[model samples]
Target: MTRPTLQGHLDGWSQGDDLRRDVASAVLALAAAGIRISELLAAGPLAGALATVRGHHADGDSQKELDVIADDLVREALAAAPVALLGSEEADEAVTLAPAGTLAVAVDPLDGSSNIDSNMSVGTIFSILPFVGADSLLQPGSAQLAAGFLLYGPQTALVLTVGAGTQVFTLDRATGAFLLSEARAFVVPETAEYAINGSNLRHWDGAIRSYVDDCQAGTEGPRGKDFNTRWVASMVADVYRILVRGGVYLYPGDARGGYAQGRLRLVYEANPIAFLMEQAQGAATDGSRPILDLIPTHLHQRVPLVFGSRAEVERIARYHGGASAMPERSPLFGRRGLLRA
Candidate 1:
């Protein structure tokens, strides 16, 4: 049987609606840009120091050469689509694409750019929402009409959802098309793996530290089951792995100066990921709250992101709420043991 192409999928969904058609156009544009980006990344160093630090965002995140290039590529592609506002991580302000268009697009043009030099997996995450004048791009994740990500890895793939079940499509280099790979992707509710930056254990709050500690304890500890740990330092890669297999990914806020609110952007990163996770039968949260329900106060605002297997995510929330079945460490040691005050 012939596999359905991305265009075919979008065409079937957009049929007679103008807004849906425009949204489909924007998604197609993103897929086209992803193809170009995958090719550029395949060239590695031949692409001329794509990982070189060109500058820094206003928030101090280093802006790499590839980040700017990917942003330009995505913007140029969206220019032909009916996109009114473009909110990109590389841009300090949202760009007005088509003043009269009805769709607002938020994107992390080049996610995981730090992995560029290492030939690690990276991706582009996008959220499509209805244009509602000045506050169109600031709407909460729950308002998203569609969200997805293009993974440029061993095989370039597109994982998407349009208020329907999440689906996966892989690029067929020979045909130059994205063909259906997984028609209805679902996240397994339970998991025996997790991803997080373990080095920050010292700075994490009691909840995060407690969760990690329990996972580390294995069958001999509270969970009563051995668990594996995986951290690619790339959100897209880690989340993709969890979506395919079963696991949990956490980037929680800690006591650090700049990282008190977490590092991922709420609009382009966490929101889109949360939307996809929920669509795939998974869950996402900012520790104790649902990620989709959180309202964005600004475009570049950061928030703690924890997503993956539903049960694991909820358990993490319970840990945060101090309602876990695990025994407390003791008040003498403070909230997180004898680590600090």
Candidate 2:
């Protein structure tokens, strides 16, 4: 496949002018709303209190900062045309639409909220799925037609798609528009250079532990390749790294309480990331299940996340496989066979 340079991709942005207009407008809206909340935290008193829980936020507590930001962004994003329903991770119900369009956007308005207090990078992940059939806001993940995420960081970038290829757009401060950083038909590498979080080794399942063990062993392990590990405690940061350089990023389940399912929400985190992975010729899964196939049942539903380079992820899935699972075997000796007992 012919690979296009970043500039070449930017030149093609005119092709999807309509979406560009809608999404571009949404960007401004996001900024206007983001500035409001980010400014709030930037002020006194509350800032000091939030800084206490900078890296880690206790669950069931007041995430008021996140709540306001999410509500604002969702309200603004839904204002765009072709948006039918609004589903927010922070909201208790699926917001209905007028008789406009049948497109539904599921948004994680404030992802990595804990990072907000610490001045760490956070992001907004949204999946634009079909709202035509079944009329279910609690529908399956397969219904997604498009997905994207906005990283509010050093160099804020927007990664999005509408079923074609995923594209990365950087916010050009001077022009106040998105300039393309990557074009259609991008390729994410097979072997990974980095993985995440290994300290939970004792609590991890045998499969997860074995996978990391192999990577830790690197070239000496089953696969003759060097590897690295990194964990930023922020999904946006990890994803940005993987997108910039090719690597596998995982947030899987361990025996730890509240992590048995997953830490990140499914509707926002997994769905959008899954879309981006597939678009970039990478992969996304919940260990054994394809992320796009799962459905959301609760407001803040969580699921295992394993995505990035295709081959490495498939291998990880093998270890995760049990009865009636996908491909069920890790390449133990660089060959397609069952794991040695």
Candidate 3:
């Protein structure tokens, strides 16, 4: 049987509605840009020093050469689409694309650019929202009309949801088309796997540290089951793995100096990912609160992200709320545990 193409799916979804049609158009544009980026990434070093530091964002995150290039590519792709405002991680402020357009797009043109030199998986995450006026781009994640990500990995793939269900499509290099792979992807509610940066244990709050400690304790602990840990240091790669297999992922805010709010951007990163997670029967939160319900105060605002299997995500929230058992600290060491600074 022939697989349904992304265009076919979008065509059926839009039917003849003006807004849906424009959304479909914008999605196609993003896919086009993803294809180009996939080719460039496949070239590796042949594409020049893509990992070279280009500059720095106001938050001090290093801007990479390929980051800028990907931003340009995506912006160029959306130019002809019905996009009124473009909120991108690479841009300091939202850019006006089509003053009269009815859609606004928030995008992380190139996520995980640090993995460029290492040939690791990276991706582009996008959130499509209705243009509602000056605050269009600042709306909460709950207002998203559609959200998705293009993973440029061993096989380029697109995982998307348009308020229906999440779907996975893979690029057929020979046909140059995205073909349906998983029609209605759903996240498993329970998991024995998790992803996190274990090195930050020292900086983590009692809740995060307690959760990880319990997981690591295996069958001898509260969970009563062994768990495997995975961390790719790339949100897209890690989240994709959890979406496919049963697992949980956490990038929680710790006591570290510039990381109190977490590192991922709320609009382009967490929001889009949260939307996809919820659509796939998973869950996402900023520790104790739903990610989608949180209103964005600014475009580049960061938020702690914890998502994946619904059971695991809720358990995490319990940990954050102090309802879960926390590890004990010895009196000799006090609150500043001997192992922690």
Give the worst 10-residue stretch by lDDT in candidate 3.
332-341
Tens-digit lDDT string for candidate 1 (257-338): 9999999999999999999999999999998899999999999999999999999998887777654644478765323321
lDDT against the true structure, each candidate? 0.91, 0.67, 0.91
Candidates 1 and 2 compared by lDDT, better number = 1
The list of candidate 2 runs beyond 4 A from truth reads 1-67, 80-82, 97-99, 133-135, 185-187, 323-341
Estimate, for each residue in 1-341, the C-alpha lDDT of model 2 and write its tens digit: 34443334433543566654444344345444544444444452564454343222335434545555556756764676556677776666667653455566677777776676566777777776655643545666766666777777777677777566888877666655556677653546665475667777788876776677666666665556667787888787778778777788888888887889868888767878988888788888998788888877764688889988887778778877764432234565443222321
lDDT of 3 by residue, 1-341 (tens): 89999999999999979999999999999999999999999999998999999999998999999999999999999999999999999999998999999999999999999999999999999999999987898899999999999999999999999999999999999999999999988899999999999999999988888788778767766577789999999899987898899699999888988999999999999999999999999999999899999999999999999999999899888777653344455575233211110
Compared with the true structure, the alpha-carbon lDDT of candidate 1 equals 0.91
TM-score of 3: 0.95
Report the Cα lDDT for candidate 2: 0.67
